[model samples]
Target: MYKIYNTILDFSDYLKYDFLSLSDKPVTQTPTSISIQFHQKPESNFVWIDSRDYPGLFASGYSNDPTELWKCLNDAILSYFGVPRYEAKKRGLPYSLPLPNGQAIVQQDAQKYAGA
Candidate 1:
């Protein structure tokens, strides 16, 4: 059976690391105000959790199988660094991150997630 879960990031951590984000429309507010409301989307490309529990602190992923769940989470992180899931699995690496002077190369596939 699948269960709901959450992931969180510290404000300081978010500030220090580069991540991906998407924008959301604000709730009711005055038109004259300069401030606007924004919600942080999942930095991961594979999954995103939109919850109201903790504002920007609480995020979640849902899956019945633990392995699949972790894979999705890992995939999301890897995609952020422009790595595909297949490459990470082949190299036996949790995920791939670009090095300052090194590049991670992945061949284009006709179908994504198709096993060799």
Candidate 2:
């Protein structure tokens, strides 16, 4: 379980860093509004705690089985970067501010987790 928890911590840290960077973007189009966009379908990629229509990846029986560590890892990745439950259910892509360096930070993190 230590590996699982470590993975979660690392993923959470990456997300927090990425989101904070995203929040720092300068607003342009709408002075009082903030807009974010994503390249993938959030629902198909990740699961949020509040999601209803699609049960979370972990909610599936496979995720809970100790033998299915890969499933847990996949679920964690989805939960970390996928769209929030309310929005994902509406077919919304996950929203994050684009990083100034144009780096795909989330994808990198996912890869790191997978490779580990």
Candidate 3:
């Protein structure tokens, strides 16, 4: 499934963007920090990846493995920023674990999760 089933990110309701109108965007810029916005479903794990100061992106995934969800979030963010997957392995998508009840369960580790 490539890990995409559901997702979300915090964004202002008033702002707008023309993502389809993208041009001259960096094909591969230095990767940025990211995080997983996670919520628990009755029988599954849910994760959301997005940034408040950036685009109104909301990429989500459902699974039992948190690592898989984190990888999903990482890919979404990388693609959104025009950062290639190969670059993620190098520069890495530095981020923390899923947030359940607005708290992180694991310490941030880009080294272990990058290109994971």
Best by TM-score: 3
Off by over 4 Å in 3: 1-47, 101-116
Off by over 4 Å in 2: 22-116
lDDT of model 2, residue 24: 50
lDDT of 3 by residue, 48-89 (tens): 555665666556666546566665666666667776433444
Off by over 4 Å in 1: 1-63, 84-86, 93-116
TM-score per candidate, chains pooled: 0.26, 0.19, 0.46
lDDT of 2 by residue, 21-111 (tens): 5335332121121222222334453322222323342222221232233333334334544533222222222222233237422312333
TM-score of 3: 0.46
Q: Which 10-residue span in candidate 2 carries the lowest summed lDDT? A: 28-37
Which 10 consecutive residues of model 1 have the lowest summed lDDT?
Answer: 29-38
Q: How many clashing pairs per prediction, in order?
A: 1, 0, 3
Total backbone collisions, model 2: 0
- All candidates in order of lDDT, best leading: 3, 2, 1
Q: Model 1, range 1-116, lDDT digits (tens) per residue?
A: 12222113333333333233322323222112111122334553333332243233222343223344334434544443454333343333242222123542233232343344
Best by lDDT: 3
For lDDT, candidate 2 versus 3, the one ahead is 3
